[model samples]
Target: LNGFRRTPRPLIRAEYQHWAVYVGEGHVIHLAPPCDLMVALSFYFFLYNVRATVKKGKLYVVVGNNDYRINNILDEKYEPRPIQEIVQDAHGLLGKELPYSVLTRHCEHFVTELRYGKPQSCQVQLR
Candidate 1:
């Protein structure tokens, strides 16, 4: 992470637009559903997961939206939380379960909450 900028960058694969927070050493923390699909309702709740650390190399194949325009715009509006606090909070949330809502608390929401102390998803906004 150059500039220690732990921003929430998108991971696009075909039609999927997933989001993750880069926290240096080529690792990212993200909230994801149990499967490849973005939303899954299992009886009662769609499971929103926190992947403790994922390598950037594994993401190279599906990387898209290189400009990270959403993040840039959001960064401009909200004063981001300090890198250390953001990272620490992310680590602390690993293995925890967050309520999953496609139009609300998804991956983008998760990382933004970690980075900016506010939960906002451009995906949700676009919807």
Candidate 2:
């Protein structure tokens, strides 16, 4: 699979998996914590009145180009959509602001949605 390394916080390393869809040519699309002003500002205003810290995120289409090493792949029991459709779906989300929730919507959910046409997070389900 083409994705980011599953580098969680040291204390919770085994508790999560960051996922991304392999869109060919060493590129992948995944949701991640906000890394720039456009996303941070949007989430800040969106959560203005909320008591929780505004840690918003967005979807990124990155050209990893062998930055990550391949490990074993988990075979999810769903048939993936056509490669072209999945690639299109992933590309369609590039740079979009997304409401990210560890327990509801995360990286795994993003990739699964593109591949299987349904959002599902194994990490959340196992919790």
Candidate 3:
């Protein structure tokens, strides 16, 4: 926990954020980026797709929690996915390379894809 910090583009004032997927043990899977934060933030309109990787006990400084899916279960619009399949799908991606993108395939997209079977990000207009 000491060395593992939040891993994401530190755009605290920006509209987008990153979340890590805890894949059991002491490891976490997050997008490591094909480019740096300066490049992504300096050129806001440019498209970037990075490679997702598994980092053992590593995270960057990030804020906020994804409670909508976990706490919004009482909502009628919240359709929960099966935990067994989600876990299975998540584990299945442990050692594989994944396509990561800022707008199209972000950290939120990874979480949604694993838990809900569809990758979705709300921070950026996907279209």
Candidate 4:
């Protein structure tokens, strides 16, 4: 149920609303750009030396923190799928590599797919 709020960062605009699947226990699954290995190399050369590259992004299970919060704007008309189905759908994509596109494939699409069995992005559709 996580959604985006106002932020100054150029990457996060007002029109955008990020989404994630709440897998309970304060954990969430969503798609995001891979962590910068170059940055890790500079900070922890010895301990964190692993080579990994992603074309766009990957599904990640993360904790609910300051990064994700609820937004006022959401589709009230939408209904959620069964909890078991949603959980299974989210787990099925765990650690899978997914190409990300702001218009075609984004966080909204990911969460919607898990909850509705179809990939969709209201923001992109609105535009």
Candidate 5:
């Protein structure tokens, strides 16, 4: 399990607002407009700012909880192709060939290292 910190404040602010700071004149530094003291009192994690550099000509496909075909499964019409087939189709559409072994390795790392377990209060429901 990843050892992360949890602060007294919730993860998200009461309301979302972009913020900026400036320094000039005799004043030390200050923010302008849209600044509510109540909203700014909350704490958030810095790790949420992680960034990734994806190479051009490469594409990423994501399947979230919303993508699950549970109704199709119940109706007996559910048929899902293997991830390899999906990736191959994308490569064909792009008129290029990509490395399968490398992609599989990355997928494994994403599942095991990055998202090994669900977070608290996050659950998927199927009916």
Candidate 6:
């Protein structure tokens, strides 16, 4: 991840307009945007940092203003958490180069608070 430069340069903000969180059993989610989406792309930039690497299917996330949500399009009920919390959580989880134990402990504490309960089961395998 690159930080701001001393000299001024162009910045590219993601163009995706909406975000939603769905809790389910799938390892991947299909994103689709809404019809009358009229929000700033900045509002949903956190999706860029997630860095989901898919193997078999099309595995790239980009900024598009089409009707897309990252999880699933058919499922109806979904709620999105604040982007700030997601960013901070991802920073700690994704930045550290540590053993699984260390990461899982951090995830247990952090995820519990983030979800307001203990996770049924936790797994921390680096990809």
Which candidate number maximizes lDDT?
1
- Model 4: how far is 124 from its true place, Å? 1.6
**For model 2, what is the alpha-carbon lDDT of residue 8?**
33
lDDT of 1 by residue, 46-70 (tens): 4444222322322332244342323
Best by TM-score: 1
User: Model 3 RMSD to the real structure?
Assistant: 6.2
Per-residue lDDT tens digits for candidate 6, residues 8-112, read 112234321222222222211212222122112222342222221111112123223234334222123323345455434434443333221222222222333
Pairs that clash in candidate 6: 31-69, 32-67, 32-68, 32-69, 33-67, 33-68, 34-67
The true-versus-predicted C-alpha distance at residue 107 of model 5, in Å, is: 24
Weakest 10 consecutive residues of candidate 3 by summed lDDT? 66-75
lDDT of 4 by residue, 2-118 (tens): 332221112322335546666655566666544433323322343333322221222132322334455324446566677777776677777777765555666677777766667
Q: 39-81, model 3: which lDDT tens digit per residue? A: 3643366545456663333322222342211122212444446
lDDT of each: 0.57, 0.52, 0.49, 0.52, 0.20, 0.26
TM-score of each: 0.66, 0.60, 0.58, 0.58, 0.17, 0.22
Measured by TM-score, how close is model 6 to the native structure? 0.22
Clashing pairs in 2: none
lDDT of 5 by residue, 7-80 (tens): 12121443221211111121111111122332233223212222222121201111112221111121133233
Return the clash pairs for model 5, or none: none
Off by over 4 Å in 3: 1-9, 12-15, 23-28, 34-45, 54-78, 125-127
- Among all windows of ten consecutive residues in candidate 4, which has the lowest summed lDDT? 50-59
lDDT of candidate 6 at residue 68, scale 0 to 100 = 32
C-alpha lDDT of residue 120 in model 3: 60
lDDT of 2 at 71: 24
TM-score of 5: 0.17
Candidate 5, residue 20: how far the Cα is off, in Å: 33
